[model samples]
Target: MTELTVKKREAVGKKVKAIRRQEMVPGVLYGQKQKNEPVAVDKSAFEKAFLAAGETGVINLKIEGADKTVPVMIYALDRDPLTDKITHVDFYRVDLSQAVVAEVPLVFIGQSEAVKNEGGILVTSLKSLEMKSLPGNMPKRIEVDIAGLKTFDDVIYISDLTVPKGVEILNEPETAVASVKPPRTEKEIEAAKEGPAEEPAVEEAAVPADEEKNGGQQPAAEGTERPSEEKKADA
Candidate 1:
């Protein structure tokens, strides 16, 4: 477990900004049946601890003037939009004997024969698995070997995973964790590279200038006689 030392923080509201200016981050620690305690830790130390422990790994948090250290996990974080610096944090105390739910990242190992020999694509449906285990039993990450995927029809499901004795995966047993997809045909690859075909442009009918001026009424043809001329001829 990683160890981090923090001090009791009296800064609150706008005064918390003063703590940051001094290279300290303001945070709160709380858990089930636990009182919320405000604390401050060195920015550099907090960052190092966070990187090592992530959100699931337990940390031994030592508070200044306190007799004993608290076992806690990083619960949440607030970061600056521009600099991505940690502005605030939350810690949750954990009981050593109690089981905790955490998401463990899935690390794929080994190359699949389908992908290496048959040129098939490896598709991973799950990035992580939610499981319940004691903090000490919780693994940093779960390793998934893809060597068994020798064909496109082969699939690795949640039920196929092997975990520590105390860890219980919460995902459905039928959930597919990884699989090999058949390679795309040459035509399909070409179509994807070219993208969708553009639609044909519709051409507007050409209108005579005279018809436009006369509210879309076409003029008489050269050989066609006007109403007045026809009347004169009949007379």
Candidate 2:
């Protein structure tokens, strides 16, 4: 668990933008059966704690002037899309004794012989799993071993995952965590490279009625007389 200090914040709405300039990141803390309180923490301190805690593990939030430190988990984080700076955060207070559900990231470890030796593509079907555990028992991340993947047909499933004694995985044991797919054939590779076919070009058969087809001259009217044989006879 990481311990971080924060201060109670009275700033609300538009004032938060100003608070950020002072290197104080504004956030709110709320949870089941917990009071919603606005708080602010030094951006540098918060970043250090967040990196350690991620979102699954518990954090010890010691607010200034508060009597007791609170256990919290990162509920949400908003970031600047372009800058990728942490904009605002939502902290979820958690009861140490009560069980809560969170998604723990799956870290794939070890090289698979199927991929290293054979021409196979490694596929990670599940990147995370839902788990229920007390705040004290929660893990920041889960590790899935891929060393057993010796063949393209082999896979690592949820049943193979190991967790802390108190943690409960809420997914089926048969769920595939990682596997090696057989290498793509030349035909398949070519088809993928070709992409979708181009649309057919428009034909010219639907020309407008006012437009001439054979030439610029319009056809002679049906009843119009033909020109007399003006051709001079051979002399």
| Candidate topping lDDT | 1
Alpha-carbon TM-score of each model against the true structure? 0.80, 0.81
Residue 180's C-alpha lDDT in candidate 2?
95
- The candidate scoring highest on TM-score is 2
Where does candidate 1 clash, by residue pair? Answer: none
Per-residue alpha-carbon lDDT of candidate 2 for residues 1-235, written as tens digits (9 for 90 to 100): 6999999999999989989999988999998776799999999999999998898878999989988988889989999999999989999988888999998999989889998999788999987899999988888899887889999889888998889999999999999889999999999889899998799999867544544653444455679853444633432
TM-score of decoy 2: 0.81
> Model 2 has how many clashing residue pairs?
0
Off by over 4 Å in 2: 196-235
Model 2 per-residue lDDT at 196: 81
| Model 1: lowest-lDDT 10 consecutive positions | 224-233
Q: Which stretches of candidate 1 lie over 4 Å from their true place?
A: 203-235
